[model samples]
Target: MKKLPIILSLLFLTLCCVSCKVGRFVYYNLANITDYKIFPSRPLVNDSIVFHYYTTEQDKAKVPKKINYNGSEVAFDDFLADNKTVAFLIIKNDTIQYEKYFNGYEQESIIASFSMAKSVTSILIGCALDDGFIKSVDEPVVNYVPELKDNGLEKVTIKHLLQMSSGIKCEESYINPFGDAATYYYGTDLRKALSKMKPEREPGTEFSYSSCDTQLLGLVLERSLKGETITEYLDEKIWKPLGMEYDASWSLDREKNGLEKTFCCINARARDFSKIGRLYLNKGNWNGKQIVSENWVEESTKPDTGLGNVDYYKYQWWLSSGGSYMAKGLLGQFIYVYPSKDLIIVRLGKNYGEVAWPELLTSLAENY
Candidate 1:
């Protein structure tokens, strides 16, 4: 009977993990492009309305299809396929100039764009501001999510979260199972998990790329929504208005009426994601119906370093010095827009795969 106690202890620990996110983390290994497949999600359903892009034979433009990578010349399509690219698209003048799918993916297949959801959340925030759900950017987050006041987040403004300058600290690593990333990504109760969060310093001093800042923005949005879920808000403001061709989903911290992870996890198909790039490319107007305010879109994609912020990141969108910007995510998901060329490029990959994607996109926008 000596081994009975030890066996029981091991059994207990195993059960505890099995009942929680740790078991999921162990099963999934590191976060992957497929993480959304295993998580409980909220549906963003579409109505009968749909918008089709303008296309023509002449709309498709030709460009350099061969490039030297790693000191060897390879076909650009082969290079993309070998480098884990699943879906790629180039849209110009509201038409799909080029579209390709590799690795057994199709236009109907779903891919999770982690952190690209941050830009979408910022869009919703802008919508809320326009709708009077949120007063202004300068308003403190505690005004919406009063629960955060206990963590000394009262000084943190909506702008701080949008700019990623909120000094509130959480471990940013995605590979660590016990870290905040895992806790927020896989935990069952985000409401409960949030109370454990504490600020590393006072608000809005230096730029820090923390997913926690984005989740806090999600929480603030949730509270201010007033009897509506975040998913519903997105559908009403974006999906329906943009006439997204396929239905998409947003990951939640739990299965039923749970808080959206909101820092990440907007599961969608590649073509549908292109519409986002298209939206910003036209400065947030979709077919003459303003989706988000033009002023908001300009503020989001513009490069600014003032107020302790980085020039490359503004309002949850990434900017380049030459007036290009993108919504980027882990595992190489991108919705790149170059307004100067009237081009929008979308790439969804399993991983970055030894390619500096931003530079490549810049080259394509400039030369193609």
Candidate 2:
């Protein structure tokens, strides 16, 4: 009977170890929090692309040290400090205006894009549209993903996914281990993970932010190409043409033929990420060559009326009241573009305190 006690003790230790591991995983993800970091990403190489350098002539004009925030004035220095900003860059008229790096981050350091990858994925969809791989944004997702033909997902279209109005029942809670977001982030089989999802409402009826919409779009992109990997397609179409200075990486769910975590977690340099803004600012023309269609650029950035009352989201890009669009990621990664002023601002940081960024950007646009 003494063996019963020892067996019970062993089982308890095993359970404790398992619980500890799970706890560590949740703590590291911190999906519920706004200040979590994305790590352990895979490399997305840019081998054939020649480096394209931005014309560098630093402007010495001092940015405003203070701006209004929530009926109170807040210093920009304090904003950076309180928000744990690691890098801040500004490019105006194709010239580097102000550039600074903090927290030991250098120009060459690769940072995670978190949800900014959604914008990139949307760009890929544009490229696919241009290539005729995708006939139109109005096409049903089930047309490409035959597995979802019988499911209720057939009602969803590419436009709905891009606008985050797919109406899928995928909860974007990162903290819940059993939630759809966690499963898509950590699960091994993305196809299986996506296949199980069903629409909770009529597709495109209302706007709802869910990462699963983007993942489904990624699958459609993959299936449309028939056999091309997203990394390869990205390198061939955008990365090479945009003249990216550094190679970027996209994280995958598994090692062999694993699907990219397309909804988030693209690792790239701050400067290279700015190229995207430049592309849109120039109306999809890069160095006199058209990359993405001008029509697509206009359609993607402007607010979609189909999203109902939500005017902030448009084709995976975030829209502001001033008609300026931005690519934002978790934990304060932002690439703000103002085409009217030929201005682009890139901010990479660990966290951003509750500061009025739109007001700050607008002020900078007006002043500069």
Candidate 3:
């Protein structure tokens, strides 16, 4: 019966193999908790966070002018009905004429911006450039975040990363459980998660969206101003200066630093978010203060020099052929702006993954 020991060992080995497979899956799916929640409330307004509120007089003057558009009311209703559009705001000529919050949402409710944060990053870059904190977009990314110097990603430029052409291979499917995007979120340190990737193409050659590209940009921002974090920089340079009326919160990494460069998760009042768009509409000038340079605004909105369509991507912001630009986030979070029309629209919802946002935009464009 010596074969009994062999059989038992085989059984133990099989069990161990199965356990290891299960453990790997768990590792891939599980996210560590520095802090996490399904629908977390945003921080209250104070010195750390502030919101921009419209006074009664300002509100009266800021109402939008009516427009004659060809889109049907029924179609819009259908969009809201079928899609999980939690918040929608339409600003025309720097005024709020149409604003709404659905799905148990309110005026002060904080919603995740998802990738919309990238546009915010673009603005921060503009401010840095305007302040002479950063010399140019064409500078090698390693110039800011020196730790990336020896890595293959050293070839990537700030401009390339902004345009989503950093040449890093990435899969950005959030719905897929085992996807790289999902795996990155599950990691204990999302910032460090990016350094594990390899460069797949020549920097600025083709368009391939990579969250890691933006994460690396965050690293650059963190390194740029000595020991200052991105959140602190944004608060001093952007958020506080704009006089945001809400205390917006950003999800952090293991280092407790704001992931400012991409996958935006700031939660602010609808009007506060619009203020940012307003700042851009005015070419980075805010209340006589040039928070960011006029030249930087012009360049950020322009098309990239790389392979992709200039209309599709512009300095980490997306500009349409109609001269309109947007802060687009996954699941239908959008801060849409049209300079010619003086229009700014903000929508926060879960319809992005399942609904056709482009179709809605087309209808709105044709109608408005």
Give the per-residue lDDT digits (tens) of candidate 2, residues 1-368: 99999988876765564334243345455542222133334455655655454565444544556766667778765666566777787788777777777767778887888888899999999999999999999999889887886677878889889988888898887677777877777666788888887878988788888899999999999998889888788888888888788878787776778787789878888888898889899888988898889999999888758545278889999988567888888777888998888889988877665655656666677677
Alpha-carbon runs more than 4 Å astray in model 3: 1-81, 255-261, 305-310
Whose TM-score is greatest here?
A: 1
Worst 10 residues of 2 by lDDT: 31-40
Q: What is the C-alpha lDDT of each candidate?
A: 0.87, 0.78, 0.66
Which of 1 and 3 is ahead in lDDT? 1
* Candidate 2 regions with alpha-carbon error over 4 angstroms: 1-24, 31-42, 47-59, 65-78, 307-309
Question: For all the candidates, what are their Cα RMSDs to the real structure?
Answer: 2.7, 4.2, 6.7
Alpha carbon lDDT at 164, candidate 3: 83
Which 10 successive residues of model 1 have the least lDDT summed?
55-64
Give the per-residue lDDT digits (tens) of candidate 3, residues 1-368: 99999988876765564323233334334322111243222242435544333334435643334322334333443456456777777777655566767767778776667777788877877777776778888899878766666667777788888888888878876655556666454333555666576777888778877777777776766667677666677777887788777677665643344344345556566777788788888889887989888988888787765465345777777777567787887667777777877767777775553556655554465456
How accurate locally is residue 96 in candidate 3, as Cα lDDT from 0 to 100?
Answer: 59
* Count of steric clashes across candidates, in order: 0, 1, 11
> Would you estimate the TM-scores of all the predictions?
0.94, 0.87, 0.79
